[model samples]
Target: MIRFIDLGDQILEGQSEFAWWDTISDSFEEFSGNQTWPNWKCFEEDYLLDEVREMIQDMRPLDRYKSLFPRDWSGTFVSAEDRKKRYEKGICDDIIDEDT
Candidate 1:
């Protein structure tokens, strides 16, 4: 089945190694059910937004998109904010799993 790494790769260029599988697998084990593949499409927009945010520092979102990735606007850029959100979400999810 499709996974986060693969989803990252397809949705965002050069993002295949964004996360660690061992952690994901271990987390999945605690879910107490089958681990279905992630929904890549749902994340594609966020990923693209983040990728654009990476190239240009201290710049507005629209400016970055227009200047850095105008031709290739797939919203693949992952921003620091997005990463932080993901990290927090993961931590929360992990905690819940641990408690269960």
Candidate 2:
């Protein structure tokens, strides 16, 4: 039973910028009772707005951030055999160290 408010005129022409605040307020109320990790009701509107505005202002284009990493960065995967070998080696090393 999610209910949304009609921001009608508040979303028109010169009012659209501030309309986000009302939208956020409505969403906060809508989800406040749910078992969400971040309880939106715990935060004040002004503080949330300030933090959101700052985050938006500080955001860079995704491609720009992506370009900072290696283009050939695909070595994070491991085969089943490699994982099994590593696990066996770890167990063997632990047993040897314990014996010593």
Top-scoring candidate (lDDT): 1
Predicted candidate 2 versus true structure: per-residue lDDT over 11-88, tens digit per residue = 333221111122334543311232111211222233334434455335532233234433443323433454566668
What C-alpha lDDT do the candidate models reach, one value each? 0.36, 0.32
| Model 1 poorest ten-residue lDDT run | 28-37
Instruction: Evaluate model 1: give its TM-score.
Output: 0.18
Q: After superposition, how far is residue 94 of candidate 2 from its true place, in Å?
A: 20
Model 1 error, position 80 (Å): 37
Model 1: per-residue lDDT, tens digit, 1-100?
1112333455344443222123423542111122222333433344345544454235333343233322433435554455566778784332223332
In angstroms, give how far residue 48 of model 2 lies from its true place. 21
What RMSD value applies to candidate 1? 17.6
Q: Pairing residues by index, what is the TM-score of model 2?
A: 0.21
After superposition, candidate 1 runs with Cα above 4 Å error: 1-37, 56-100
